[model samples]
Target: MVAEEAEVLVVGAGLAGLRCAGVVAAAGRDVRVWEAGDEVGGRIRTDVVDGFRCDRGFQVLNPAYPELARSVDIANLRLQHFGAGVGVRREDDAVILAHPLRRPTRVPGMLAKRAVRPSDVVALVRWAYPALRPSALTANTGGDTTLLAALDDAGLRGELRRVVDRFLAGVLLDDGGSTSNAFALLLVRMFALGVPALPAAGMQALPRQLAGRLGDRVSTTRRVVEVSRDSAGWRVTAEDGAVARARHVVVATDTRAAAALAGTDPVPTHGVVTDWWASDREWPGPPMLFVDGRSGSRGPVVNTAVISAAAPTYAPAGRHLVQASALWGPGRPEPAETQMRAHAAEILGVDAGGWQPVIRHVVRDALPAQPPPLRTRRPNRAGAGLWVCGDHRDTASIQGALVSGRRTGAAVLRALG
Candidate 1:
């Protein structure tokens, strides 16, 4: 109703803020969402530049996220699924790891690769078979170890280890593969459910759908810079002098931003650089993520793939869009543009000179590092009248952001009662 007083105010129009606001509004509360940027989705942005749809950072939506149903409209997104599995590029040949159930016909092709020896295939089956059972999950109690340590203890070595290593490195963004086992298991469960995909319109479609449902409740281009309490309830003032008062304020910003607002320490993070390219030719076959068999040491690009092949909207008519990504720690120099292009060509066995550069995004705080002693969900309540939710407070992924938002929404509802 465009009232200055909202029962609940959400400071961030990204996934977390939108999801929380959606839940609050559905609960019959008047909630307002304020965003600093003109566009929603935060890091999950997609821009059409020179006929190429460039996603700000490399991201994928795991339809298997438990909280996904609560936040996003699955069927409405029109997701474009990636191929059943990934392709690992060895020296001369590419090894395909097709999901046995989804692509039964591709089983023979996967087995033909030298990397997938008979024993490795059996080991993969032994691991994958029982994992399908939800009951197979072991409780995440106190002690935890790195993913590399777990793989080694399980006796995964050589080509099999390298294949899994490269794949996890790409997905986890753990350059040294040191993320905690519990968190990695959570990710494994999500990945095992089905192939990840992009929205037919772009990644923005997910948040767009959430915001569309919110309608005019969201105020874009209004930055909520300060949250203070007077004798009244609470007041949130934007840098532009715009103000809104609410009983409760949810700070669904990034870890750093949230920490800055709350005067707390920011969560440690890992940086990632994604380079976008457009080419006249499409990549070889079905849409698949290509990972380096040599464990990222051979090149700056740990993985490269044609996103347009998986989601046609990523490129204009007859053009192809490719993405290559590398991860680094904070304060480290990002991989240069030339290094990324050359490394991508080396990994994909393509001509780097031909593909034109679309854009390069070096995100210093791309993801929260999931080191040992990990807690899947951090605190959602910043204080009695304030709250926070984002990847920083959750599992450090789009799924985490959604889940945290939904959780905080419930908390706010309970507080109101």
Candidate 2:
């Protein structure tokens, strides 16, 4: 086959790749993207099964993300926002701890449930105050510590602790609270500022929207296996033997793939297994993510949500869609279908006996682990001709991926000039 020539070639069609290509193309540079997967969006994919839309992994798009708002057309996504709160499942009942300001009417009911203590509430405010300021993370002035330590230091040990810890674990996919305190606080700040939502179509819509802007520049089913320096610039070869020669190359794949192609060390990643179910009955509770708050209840599921309640388009007209997410760890395996169903039922306070299994997605590298002393930006320029960018290169989030991509694209442009 004749070798394809590209002025700039980007490997992987995830958010980073699409964003980088967009930047380069916007600058009037010839850029092309090759995605190994059958579709764009990388891990942010959705599968249609029996008329239900099941995202590869449970994910939400936060409009508060600066890069997201700047890059994508948020209105087009048709976002269905979740309630600004979390449902904590206790031994006997489930209580929703909503934002006092956003859901003022619910606050009286929440306080009546005694779901949170005044002291715990005070501690939470103190711990989250610094995170609310974007300057804190930008300047990296405050000393960092583990999330657990920070919470302890703030004296947040109460029912609120259990609820918040599990809720965050589901979001970060880190059950042990080993994530950076600063990072966790930043996430909390986002939650405070914006309500995350699912697109009317699904989470994959975000990347699809990005890829659509590139027109024919994005190519899927092109699993890149090699990237080596050549006289002109670099050569990218796919497993199918197709070759692309470019003046600049960007490794914009996942952490392991990017590290392998860029000759850099791979960062640790956290995995998650999400089970999707379709039930004829709907959950009566408000559309919010639920976490186990019952003391010492060590079930496989970290969080469960009535996805259809939040986004009706995800399910058929009469059916409801539910998602149960569990962390994938060392020696930990996917739970049996029955166990997941039972736990989800318990969490939702509904009968899941008849709920039909739709799909179970096991993503081994769902997220690059973010540890303490948070470093938002990692080295992106790997060599003279090769560069790297991903969520791993910046913060581990949609925001990070877009920022890294734009930064890498600018670097490539500068190199070519």
Which pairs clash (backbone N, Cα, C closer than 3 Å) in model 1?
none
Collision count of model 1: 0
Range of the 10 consecutive residues with the lowest summed lDDT in candidate 2: 99-108
How well is each residue in 288-374 modelled by candidate 1, as lDDT tens digits? 888878643687787888888898988998989989999877555788888988888876777767899899887777788888766
lDDT of each: 0.80, 0.89
Candidate 1 Cα outliers beyond 4 Å, as residue runs: 1-3, 100-109, 122-138
Using TM-score as the measure, the top candidate is 2
What's the true lDDT of residue 321 in model 1?
91
Off by over 4 Å in 2: 100-109
Model 1 lowest lDDT segment of ten: 133-142
lDDT by residue (245-296, candidate 2, tens digit) is 9999999999899878989889999999899998888577899999889889
